[model samples]
Each structure stands twice: as C-alpha cells, then as structure tokens.
Target: MSAAERVPGQFTLVLHSHLPWLINHGRWPVGEEWLYQSWAHCYLPLQRILRRLADDGYTDQLSLGITPVLAAQLDDPAAVAGMYEWLADWQLRAMEAAIDDDPDRRASGHREYRAAAAALDDFAQHWQHGGSPAIRDLLSTSVMELLGGPLAHPFQPLLDPRLREFSLHEGLADAQLRWGTRPSGIWAPECAYTPGMESLYRDAGVSHFMVDGPTLHGDTALGRPVADSDVVAFGRDLTVSYRVWSPKSGYPGHGAYRDFHTYDHQTGFKPFRVTGKSVPPAAKKPYDPTLVDAAIDTHVDDFVACIRQRLIDESARLGRDALVVAAFDTELFGHWWHEGPIWLERVLRRLPEAGITVGTLATARRDGYVGDPVELADSSWGSGKDWRVWEGPQVAHLVQLNREVTDTALDSLDKRLPAHGSADPGADPRDLTADQILRETLMTVQSDWPFMVSKDTAAGYAQDRAYKHAHATREICTASDAGRDARAASLAAGWRRADNLFGALDARRLPTRDWSEK
Candidate 1:
C-alpha cells in the first residue's frame, strides 16, 4: 500500500537557507566565509541529495526557503567568483593537511582532501554559473517546493508596514526573475508574526507561511488560517523538530558523531569525535568514519520512529488525519552537524517505507491538513517565542537606529521622488539617491544583527553591520535632503559598490504614507 494510504497523517520538512549580504564585506570569522562555508558544506550537499531523490521519483519531499537577499548573493557575479576561489583554497588546505606531521592530522587531511575535491567538481559542474541555475534545476525536478521571504530577511512584525509590503513584493519579484516562478509561501523571516500582517500577505498573493508552534498556541497538528484570511500558517512541530536540534539535546551531540567544535589547530580541520559530553577537546577521540556510519544509522532509525509515532498519536488525538512539520536552518546539515545531509536523506527515504507519508508544506495545505483560523499574537521563533530577541533591551540601540534610519530614508524619498499619481512617476527607474537610501535602510533592518546581539554570537560583528548601514542611510538621506546631489551620488555610489544586492529595488514604489500608524 502507498504511504499515504497506510498512515493517517503526513509529515513535511522545511529547511530555510539564508545569510545576510556578505560579498565585499569582511571575510574570516563573520562575513564571506559564512557564505562560502554554507555554500560548500550545506547547500551543495543538500541539493545533491535532492537531485538524487528526484531521479528516484520523489516529488515534494520538503520545502526549501531561499531568502531573496541570499538569492541575490548566490547569483551575483562577484560572489560566484569568490565562492570558486574559496573552494580552491579549501582543496589546497586539505592537500596540505594530507601531508601533515601528525598521523591524526594526516588522516583527517586525507578525508577532507577527497571531500574538497568532490566539492570542487560539483561547483565546476553545476554551481560555477551561480546558485540560481542549480536551484532552478532542483525546482524543475519537483523534488521540493521553494519558499521565498522578504528582502534582507527583516523582522516583519516590527518593520514599518509600507516597507514590509514593499520588501515582500520585491522579494517575490526577485525570485521570479531568478527561477521563473513566484513563491506563494514564505518562511516569514524568523517565523515572526503580528496581527493584521496576514491581510498584507493576502494582498501580496501569498497563500501560506510558517510560524513557531507556540505562535499557533501549540496546536500544531495542522495549518491554521490567520485572522479570517484564506492564507494558511503552518507551525513547526517542536516534538519532531527538537529531536534533532534543541539547545541541550540533539542527534549531533551523540558521542560517535564528529565534534563540530574540536578543531585541529594546525590544519584547521575538525579531527575528533564528540566522544563524550564532558570530554574536553584534547581528550576527545580521533574522528572515525566507521563510527559515524553507525551513529547515522542509529539516529535515522530513532528519527523515523519518532515521526511515525507522532503522526499516529496526533491523528488519534485530533480524530482526523494530522500534519507534522519539522523546520530548521539549512546550515545545520553538513556545515554544523557534519552528518546531517546523510541523516536527512536517509530519514526522508525511510519514513515512507515505514508507512509514514512525507510531503512539503504546500502538499499538506492542498491535501486538507488545515484547521481553524487563529488570531495569532506577536511571536517569533526566537528566545521566549517572542519579539524580545529583536526588540529587547540588549538591542534597544539597534531598534532605535533602525527606526531613525527608516524614517530618514522615507522622509527623504517622499520629498525627492514623485508620488504614485504624479506626472510620470515611472519616468526613471534609476533613482541612485533614493535607491541607495532604500538599500542601506533595508540592510540596517535585517533581523540577523539583533539575533546575533541577543544570542551573543559574534555580537561585535553584528553591531558593526547594523550601525554601519544605518549610518550610510542617514548620510545619504542627509546629502540628498540638503540638495548636495553630487555628494549624495558619490556616497550612494561608494555604498553601492560595497553592499550591492537586489538590483531591482526602486524607491519610487515605496508608500508615501506610514501605514503602520493607521
């Protein structure tokens, strides 16, 4: 019998792929390195698995959200060239490690060398052009559904309404340009929501989106319509998701898995197994591929069982066929967990064989896995399941800066650009001053800065990025407001060279009135 016929419920996996604009930014600890590492380790490997699954005749196995900002970087010429260079450097380092003085380092180096070689070949064969073609190919195969989000992945619940609408429209448009399809669903930046945003989503032609389970008051057995709108809000099932990625417990922490933190300082390779929770880096055992194979098999079985049990339980509890969604950041696979991609492919393949139905969020919605309309409160997937992470006292200064910059940019554009009904408002699509102001403003409002600051992961870098963009926005707006056209043009040009993404952004389309106040 088919999996859907055997099971009383369905399961959907969502992987959100995102990174703030990083090209021309700093490298090393917190910049382009992030883009290259995730590209090489996570995106490449994950897509390969999806491609194989498609060949094996799988369709709608999961939903993949690629933020427009990340998409822009993925398809950018400069970023594409830089990623290739980074992969070449990775191969060189692996070769150096293969010939290291220490036996453990040499063993790790050989493993890394082969992996690097494979990655280089994959890039040359598929990703050399840019991420769009590779992503488009996957979409064309129907292996997964693509989810789009607003420009720069801003916290929409806190964003000004006009900017919120503008960002989403532009983001969907950007996706259409790249993949020739506009996503009807979004990952909803941070899975954050506030009252009345659903109307804006409906207006933008979005049909479905995601939120934390708590945002739906923990009733996650099905998607819910938000506040009388036809748009559906799918909540992540914490029961299944936390099994693989909670703060304290997860499959990646298993003793036999490769330790992501314990690096070989000499060769910059992670050369040790987790061994034990209490074990120090120096006391950890050398990584063994054989151990990882067994560990992955064990975890795959455990996860498959967990999903099967949950589906059965939820179906019985609801007195109807239920839906389960497990969403996580794409970087968790291969990049952070090391064995994540293998585990993912195995779980996806095994679930259906085990009498469990696996499908994408869109499938769940279309197949009648929807419940009642929910009056969702302000919520996010952040700490406390609230907006504190992006609006807390820790990031009070950033919050203030975002508001100030947004206002300055909006006020300047209002004065400079013609209104919607004015004479030939579309006369020029190239408003360098307005374009640059909006660009900087969008960068300033990205949810990453506040998230990093609240979590204290590279807080300094996050703070610097937020303030730097805010400062740029203010300066350009000031120059344009003062009729210093040349100065404003030069500043906009300089900033454009450094922080260029979203080539389709036009300030003329921004709403003249602040709709949030209404």
Candidate 2:
C-alpha cells in the first residue's frame, strides 16, 4: 500500500521485558531457571523474529522495553555462561525423555529435543558473546525502539526521590553503555505511576512512558502528554491487550495452546494442552504442535481483525487519526504462552498487509498522536488498577521493608559520602561503600518481591530475597558507621560481587535533597 493510502489509526505494541536481579541468587523453580527459560524462550526467539522483520525493511514495528536490571543480566558474563550450560542440560533432558517407554512422552521429548537443539544453536550463533551484541544488532536495524527503566525495576511511586532519581539515571546509562544510545521512553515498572513522576521523567531525558488505560481515565486511544510536561503517557488499550491474554479470557486459554501451569512430573516439561480450565494435568490431552500451529493462525486472524475494527471504530469516534497501544510483558510470548513468538511474528507481518500502520510508541509521538495534556491520577496496572497490590495489607510488610532500607541506605550514604566536592578528592573510601549501599537498596526496592508475595506465587523466595538485600544494606551501613573501614570495605566488595549489576553506578548522583522538591 502507498503511504498516502495507509490507515489513519496507528497501532503500537509495547512489550515490557523485565526480571529482578536473580543471578547468583538461586536456581530451580525460581531464580536462574526463570532467567534462562525467558532467555531461551522469549528473548532469543523474539530477537530472531524482530531481526527477520528488520532484514525485510520493517521499521519501528514495535517498542521493546528491556529494563536495566534485565539488561544487566542479559549482558552478564556469569548469566550468559550459565544459560549456555542450562541449554545443554535441557537438550540432555530432552534426549533422555525421547527414550521414555510411553509413546506419548517419547514424542513430547523428541519435540522438546528439537526445540532445545535449535535454541542451543541460536544461542551459540547470536548470544554466545552476550546479549549486548545481539541487542545492539537489533538496535542498529531500528526496527524496534528500545524502552529502558530504572535499575532493579523499582515501583517508582513508592521509591524515595533520591534513590528513584539515581536509579533512573543509572538505568538509562546502563542501556546507553550496552546499546550505544539511551532510551527516551520507559515502561514504568508495573505501569505504576504517581502524580509529579512525569516531571522526574522529563528531567531524566525521557520523553514518554506507559501507564494503564484506566490511568488515563479509560480514554486510551490517544497518547496524552502530562500536564506542563512534554513527557507523553501512552495508555495500554485493554480492549485490545486483553483479547490476547487476560485473567478470564484470551487466546492463550485455547485448548490447543500449551498449558502453562501443568507440567510432567518426571521431565518437568509442559506436555499437555490447556484442555480445559478444570482439566487435570494427567487427564488433559497431549500437546500437539500441529494443533497449536492451527490455533496460532486462527488467533492471528482474530487479532488482526480486532485491531482493524478497533482502529476503524476509534478513528470514527475521535473524528481524526487514533492510536491504540497494546502493551504486555515480553515473557508472555514464548515463556508463559509457548506459541507467543510465532504469534508475534505473524501479527507483525500481517498488520501491514491488512493496511494497519504498525509503529513504535516513539513513532506515534513523532506523528503527533499526543492528544490534549491532562493530569493523571495515582495508578498502576495492578489489581484494582491502583497501588493496592504493591502496598496493600497482603504485602504491607514488604512495603515497609523497602521504605526502611531505602531510607537507611540514603541517609547513611549522604552522611558518609557527602557530595563530590565536599568529600576528599583523592579516591574517597566512601565511594565503594556508597555504591554497595545503593546496590543493595536498589535490589531490595525491586517490585518483583512485593508482586510475588502479594500474588502468593513464590512468596517465600520473594520475601527471602527482599530481606536478604535489606540485611546486606544494613550490615554494610553498620560496619561503615562503626568506623571499621577494613570490615566495611570487605563486606561491601563481597555484596558488590554478589549483586554485581550497574557497575557504573555513581553514588554521587544520589542527591542529598529531594530534587523533586526543588
């Protein structure tokens, strides 16, 4: 289709990819497994799909938000090496399963074996060096605009202003180091927002970020710049996003799609289809790749038509060009929903063919999709579309823990480190100490802990991680306050090695006073 004949409405698909600091933390059913599974299934496959589209001259096809914490993991030498080993183990497991006595299990094993082998091969070719190179290659194509968020993916609204500002700056810097440019937009952790956060975003050099549709009072068809700021807040259109995956209904719930929760006890692989919501894992039918392939096509067509009709209806209602943004976690594609990557590839390719103008959030902003400025309320994409999930009774303890740790860390750092000029110029001892404090504080502030605890999914692990980091921060601060320079330095270095993200973190960037107040 000619440029002049293109549709008036724009569709922007935003995938917010994030995981808390899990490296060197734990493995099975939680930490490292989560990272490797996402890496092998989501990141690698999505990269292949986007790279393919970019090679074919698709520009700004989507907006991918890779949180700085996840970026650090992707680029970590330890993580890359660990993932390589994990993939090898996965292949071996598949090989063993392929020889199972049960024909159904054997067939499933073989299918898994092929997938493992292919993922291993792709990892060797594109990801052997580290994720930085792979991601840099994608950025070079400009087919997808990268969106970055604060270090550790903190709930920004509840975070201390000093730490919040520091994390945001450091996070953006991390992205720049890896990709050669800083992202102008961020997927605010959990799509959570508080009033006046936009001013902080503006100061951080961010031009836009995402919030839930209800955060914009449910009129999410157009991007709205925050009051008195150029930072545009793009609201995710639930009507479209939920059509793919939601609590009650979505394509992933189809009987043909791989079941996310049910897994074979012996091999630990999901071997059955989502036969029914009430179906037992043992009773559900075996997964068939062919059936899923057929289902993908059906869902693809359904989604395309949904978008087309949405654009047509929205454009008519607005009497002008409209924008519909569907944002989701990147893990939903290949991790939670096994057929997500294929579905993504088909959707990207089919959207333009159907005359819908697919674009990145950046492109939408550039094309004047910014509607009238408005004051947004305090909101999040969580339950009740508010901050209750993060700060409610279920997780109030975790919230208090975060607040205490953040306050203690900041207060100690301010006292010890002071500012650059105020402190001794020649290799201040407090720099390393301050760095450690911030690192532990950031990790403790990660939104994952509260979310996991609140949802009762891996609650123990989440609580443990949160307290572990908090304890580390407190211990380091205590050592420093006692003037035990040797002990403090030793403890700080040890914790640094453990957390080991944001190596470029500068404690001096942490303001002594709240910059937001100024």
Candidate 3:
C-alpha cells in the first residue's frame, strides 16, 4: 500500500521514565543500586536505540517522559562519577563469573562479561560527562518529544494546591534549563489527576498530559481536553499497553525471557530464563541470549499486530482517524525484561513498515486527533483506577504525613523568607534556608513511599526515606526559627549534598499565597 493509502489512525508510544531521589542514600539492594541498574540497563540502551532511529531521520517517533527528579540525578556530577564506578565494577563481576566452576555458569558469565564490557564502552563514549548532553542531543534531533513532570514525582491529587502549582512551574523551569526548550507535554506522575488540575497545567504552559484508560471511562481512543481547559489529557490505551507488560501476564513472562527475580548470587547477574511459573529460581534453566532473540521477534510481531488491529477498530468506531497511546514505565524495558530494548526497537521499526503512522503524543495532538471535551473524575493508573493505592487505609498515614510536611514547609517559608514581591531579592540568607526546607519537603512528598508501602515492596526502606526527609525538613526549620543561622546552614548544606536533585530550585519563586486567592 502507498503511504497515502495507509490506515487513518496514529499510534503513540509513551514511556514514562522515573526514579525517586536515591543518591547518597543507600547502596545495595534498594537505593543507588536501583539507579545504577536502570541507568546502565534501561537509559543507556534505550538512548542508543533512539539515537540510531534519529540517525535514520525518525522525527517525533515517540514521547519520553523524564521526570525532573530523574533528570537531576542523571545530570548530577557525583551521581555520574558513581555510575561510572558501578559500571566498572559490573565488568569485573562479569569477568569473575566467566571463570566459575559450572559450565552453565561459565557460559552465562561469558555472555554477561561481553554485555558489561559493551555497556562500559558505551558509557565512556556517550555518557561519561553526564546524561544531559545525550538527552539534549536527542531533543535537538526531534527523535522523541520530551515530557517533563513536577519537581519530585509527587502525587498531585493529594498535595496542597500551592505546593502543586509550585512544583509544576519549577519542574518545567528545570527542563527548560537543561534542554533549552520547555516541554508542552508531561507524563503526570502515576498518571494521577484531580478535578481542576487541568487549569493549573494550562497556567504552567503544559498543553497535554496522560492518565489511565479507565480514567476516561474506558473510551481512550483519542485525546480529550478537560472541561474548559485547553490542556489535553491523553488516556493510556490499556488494551494495547498490557500487551507489552501487565500485572497478570505479558511478553515479559515468556519462558525464554531472562528471569528478573533469578540472579547469580556471587556475580549479581540474572543467569536464568523464567523457565516455569512454579519453578524455583535455582531450578530454572540457564539463560540463552539466542533464545531471547527469537522470542523478541515473536513478541514484536504480536505487539505490532495488536496495535494495528486496535487502531483499525477504534478508527471505525469513532468514524475518524483515532489515536492509540500505549504507555508504560521505561524501566520495564531493559531493567525488568532484559530483551525489552530489542523488542522495543523491533516493534518501533516494524510498525512503520506495516503502514501504521507512528508518532509522539505531541504529533498526535497537532494532527487534530482530539475528541469531544470530557470532565474526568479523580483517578490514577493504579489498581482500582482510583486513588486507593496512595490514599487507601494501608497508606493513610503517608497521606497525612504529606499534608503535614507540605503545610509546615510552606508555612515556615512564608514566615522566615520575604514574600514573593519583597525587595530583598539578592542572595539573602533566609532564602538559602527556605530553599533547603522546600527541597526536603519536596523529597518527603515523593509518591514512591506510599506506593512501596501499599505494594509491600521495600516498605521499610520507603518508610525510612520518607521519615528521613521529613526529619530533615523539621530540623532545618527548627534551627532557622531559633536564630541558629550557622547550624541551620550546616544542616541545610548537608541535606542538600545528600539528596540534591533539583539544583535549580529557588524558594523565592514559590507562591506565598494560596492559588485560590490569586
């Protein structure tokens, strides 16, 4: 078929990349390791794929949401240095594994050694400086539309209105500083939303954001502008998204796929395939990279077919060209499912060949695929399609904790620092103290804590992080109140160095008054 005679619908691949501020916090099994693993396995490889596409002249082929918190870590000098060391150590570990006693272990070790070496080479070549340069290059080429989010990945629904507005503006400013262009789209953290947030997004210069499929009452074939707001909310096409990864089953569950849960104890490498659902990790079959190649091919075919059929069906139903947005967490690609990057590359390349118009969310909007306006209820991408995960009985305390911390941080900042329009604008000591308090407060209100607690995954560590940030906020505020400027400065500097994600944050820009009053 000629390009002009192809299907009428468009397909958008949206990947939300995020991780909480984990630098200088903890190392193995939970904190910095998570960052390094995702960086090495997901970010580096994904960018490599995108760069190849860009080299071939793919423009706005996909939309990538890099939350401000994640971007800060990627651009941090200390984090970059640490990641280099981690990659070097990974190479060494692979070398040791190649000399193991068992034949299967040795074979797996050799394979991993090659991968580790390649990753090291890639890091030195493209990422030795920091991730910002590479990310900026991608944006410049227009290979992908960058989607920026709030300062920290806070649950916007439960956060105070003033703090929410502040985070949105600051987050966009950070992205603009790094990329030299402000994003018109965002992947709202967790795809969570409340009524009236669209106006805030419009005010912040965001033209579009995402929510879950069910959030649109299961009619997610096209983007819908919320009531009386030009800012559009794109609903994730769950039918198409779950084909790649879902809670119950998906391509990542294939028997030939590397088992994410099964790892070589000594080498810290995943050495086995999923093998069987009931099989123990020790009993699982050894991983074979060759087997995964065939599986990726099959999954790629399956996924492309699914997307093609969905677009056709939805276009027919809508009586016009429709849009199918398949959104997922970026980490799921190379971090959770080892073959995900390969599958992604194949699917992206194959879709265009099949005569499907593949483009980013921005392209979809610009092409006039928006549907009738709708008033969306409060919802999220979590289970139940509501706020139960972050606000349920299991995480009620965290909800309250977020409230208290936000209130305290804003109240203290107002009391100690000059108001927004005050004349004392040039490098005041009060501004420094207030900035630290706001930083700690933002860190404390990250949505990861309640999410981890609700899922019972690393509950202890999540609780510790939340309490740690909250305590830092309280201590710094207390010192400032007592006129202990030196002590407060010391505490603030230490916390800043420890969890310094957003270096561009300035407390003076935060709204001192409520949004309602404005």
Candidate 1 ranges beyond 4 A from true positions: 1-5, 421-429, 514-518
Q: Write the per-residue lDDT of candidate 2 for residues 140-191, one digit (tens) a residue.
A: 9989999998988999999987788888988998889988999999999999
- The TM-score leader among the candidates is 1
Tens digits of per-residue lDDT for model 3, 74-166: 998889999999988988887888898988878887888798889989999998778888898898898999999999999998998878988
The CA lDDT of each predicted structure is 0.90, 0.90, 0.89
Q: Candidate 2 lDDT (Cα, whole model)? A: 0.90
CA lDDT, candidate 2, residue 173:
87
Top-down lDDT ranking: 1, 2, 3
- The estimated TM-scores of all candidates read 0.97, 0.96, 0.97
Q: List the residue pairs that clash in candidate 1.
A: none
Model 3: lowest-lDDT 10 consecutive positions: 421-430
Across 304-348, the per-residue lDDT of candidate 1 in tens digits comes to: 889989998999999999998999999999989999999999999
| Clashes in predicted model 3 | 0
List the lowest-lDDT window of 10 residues for candidate 1.
Answer: 421-430
Off by over 4 Å in 2: 1-5, 420-430, 514-518
- Compared with the true structure, model 3 gives a TM-score of 0.97
